[model samples]
Target: MEFNIPGIVNAAIPTRQDRNRNVMIISSNSGGSYNDSGFLSSDFPHSPAKLYITAESDSFDAQTLRDWRDEGFNVEYLPLGDGGSAYAARLESLAKSNNLGPCQSYGIIAYGDAASFCLEHFHVVDNNPEFKLGCLVAYYPARIPDPRGKFPSPVRAIVHLAAKGEDSIDVVGHSQMLGIQGSRRVSRRRLDRGVGAGRALDMAYPAYRYDAEPGFAEHDLDEYDRVSAELAWSRSLAVVRRALMGYMDADASVVDQNTDGKFVTRNLSQTMGTYTAHRSPHVTYMPTLTGAIDSQELQRFYSEYFLNKNPPSTELTLVSRTVGSDRVVDELHVSFKHTQEMPWILPGLPPTNKRVEVMVVSIVTLKAGKICHEHVYWDQASVLMQVGLLDPKMIPQKASERGVKKLPIVGREAARRVLQGFEDEEDGEADNELIPGWYDDEEEEEEKDEQEGKKENTGKKTKLQEEKGKQPEKASVGPETRDEDGQAETIPERAKSEPKEVEA
Candidate 1:
């Protein structure tokens, strides 16, 4: 009696051997692709029982199966149908029938369409399952299905998925949901150029070594770049190996502590004060007391070189400061005038009378207000470039000449211009308004107004004098009364007042 999966596999049942672990290799090709199977068998570092599966095995080679068996794989060819309907059921049945322990099956290595199918349906076999998949390695999957859908099954396994190339399907963007919500430990790899899916697989599993001359894994399709394939292979292998070995990358979280800003500043000032005063004794703690440092050696480093040696003139300008609960981070702009030789600070450089300006950050950890330790950081390249020792052109660093005349406008005005998009704007009418000789002065404007007022007043006075000169002779006398017909009646007017009504 032959033990075979009905409708899935044939009746050829080989005697099984006890194995420590198993690797299930899946492919979508109906005709068993012995090339991939052979490559994987030889490339895998560990000797685990390999199971080669396919969706359609109508043209399955019996000789190939014999070859794999000879190479030592407790192999079985379980054929799955379209839509992957029998995949999950057949996988579970095979595991149960083999009497394998929960951890006996190490991982699944799927390529092409099979890779996509396995990822989508891996959950079906995982949910309410009896076994654990240690890890999953998928190469150049055809299509990622329902990435947004919940896949709580594969969370237990570490997933190492690779995208084909830049132009092709973006594996990272498409599979983002799966990586974030589906798996606990997931990593992605990008193989530049259309290196093909086989190249990525070959890189990870170097089943066969290529000769000096470039050769394609698939000889029929001349689509191989040997250099790219080799680089991608190394990266893929590293990710897969690390995942299977239960190694995880380190992570750190930084929390901003609400510290007393004034106290932190005071402590930092003291540290700089010691440097300025050239007194190592005033330091809070011995330089080499802790942190892989020798106390006596550090004391010599400070007293003999840092303090006593030719300490260059420094003008420290503070840039920013952040105070945490027990730590203080200070960023400062340090200007060093290299007038004397300081072997400790500048190492072997001879005094060149050069002034170098560089930004340095100091992180100080404190306990009970006194400084416990301080770590200072600065870019040595900037300092080197400033001192003319390093050629900025060669290093590709931008050389900025110090003491360059300040812009016509700076500070608040610069900020205002930037906010107003002045850089992109053309010179409008408003630009000329503030230019010299554009508008009149207050004194000139007042003088023009005063001259116009005086001219109008003079014209009015001249008109009044002319009108008086043209007045009648009677108006000049003022006391004489004049009658209508040019007759004088002065005597009657003085005598008096009561007069009868005159005839009409």
Candidate 2:
């Protein structure tokens, strides 16, 4: 099984050569642009050889293709014709041709429909000695297929689905399907307010919307939700890195989110001594302590904001963590039963006692094995909405009159009930016919016109013109034009039409 896929391979930078891994990105569409920058910066801790494959080789946008190439990714633009067997064959062929091995850590990033297809046929590459995929990412698939099907794939994969809250696919069914599947690990997360698939991975895509103008479209108009997309991407990146390249524990002293719902500082002495004890600036929504909060200030913050003032139900579940050469990225699902009002987080609002769940990503930079800086990110808009501090009517947000529950869909029973409430609507128009007849009226008319055109043009070309068409037009030397900068420029035929000025 050989695929005639014309591809260009790219290697990592000299410094990251040893840590180089491989990632194959399968595009959903048939064609893409090729003119790409293909530059992977040094900030990316790992060197993963990225192979981007599109369906069509000849049909592609020059710029888009170049952009993929510029990012130092291997790109194969050959069509992966229709049929599931064909797709599986092409993937197997790609793996064999690339000579992917255990030494060359590998993973797959399947986008859109490609994700669904890959998830279904992923087992094809599983048993291959030359290609062992460590992690699999399905970026916004239409409907997460039943993972418990007869052809079980013993792989750990994450499925990200968009929450449009309209005539959308059955996310609950998808979640339950993944949850029930007997696999290594399968995590299903619903990104609320996400308008479409691939929106989480590609920030450039527009998000889903409900209303038009002054209604719910006011604050929710933007195509890309920076907070959701960034959070999702960070988590996805961490999962891939840990799955492919592996992870290590970052030595640091911090408040740990214990199973017993207690915030305990482990090894406080060593952690406090390792820090510079300088006052660190707080930029997030929490306004308790601001600007260079030292070790003492941090302890005070932990006591006042987290331990004492914080609600007893406060919980932070570790989602995914990636340990890099210079920094450690942690993704956490922070939640709390808002029983007490803490002015530190919500400046003026009182406790509504509502349960809240929000995702957070924290990047910790280390200087000589000591924590130098940390950048924590989470959607404040979402948190405000969840805690009932912010009014949804006043602002366009997910937590409105809608009955969408907070994430982590509890157990299988809850999942079944959640799935039962909704009717499985057709993904497409049920009334409209999707498949066309054997003969397309417009296409037949066009073909007739094309044949007539060819016949008409056959005799239009003169013998000399036909002969010249076979050969390249020789450049005729002529008077050139000068621009403001005195750069010689080619004079257009219209400009050349002007009568030559009398020599003066």
Cα deviation of 447, candidate 2, in Å:
99
TM-score of 2: 0.32
Model 1 poorest ten-residue lDDT run: 250-259
What does candidate 1's lDDT look like per residue over 1-504, in tens digits? 532222122122122121211112222222322121222334345444444434332333354344334423455654545644467666546545665432244345454455566655553323224434434444345444332233332223222233322333323122223122222222343333323533322221222222212222112225444444434333433333333323222111121121221123323223233221111222222222222133444454554455444433655655567754345677666665677666544766787676665555666643323443456666565456456655433422232253223222211122233224434565211354334455668658989999999888763533333555432212222356744322234633243243333332
Candidate 2 lDDT (Cα, whole model)? 0.44
Candidate 1 residues lying further than 4 Å off, grouped into runs, are 1-105, 126-128, 154-247, 250-380, 386-504
Model 2: lowest-lDDT 10 consecutive positions: 210-219
Residue-by-residue lDDT tens digits, candidate 2, 1-504: 542222111222122121112122222232211111112233545445544333222343344344334333454454435636676666657656666532343456554556556655553223332334445555555545433332212133565554445334432122223122222323454434434433422221212322211111112234444454444444544454444434424443332322122233433354344443332423233323221255666555544554455676776657667765445777776666667766445545677776666666777654334554556675666566565445434622564345433432221122223233345433312322223443577779999999999998765755545555543244445578854322236865443342333322
Best by TM-score: 2
In model 1, what is the error at residue 484, expressed in angstroms? 99
Model 1 pairs in collision: 30-56, 203-233
Please identify model 2 stretches exceeding 4 Å from their true place.
1-87, 123-131, 149-154, 166-222, 248-504
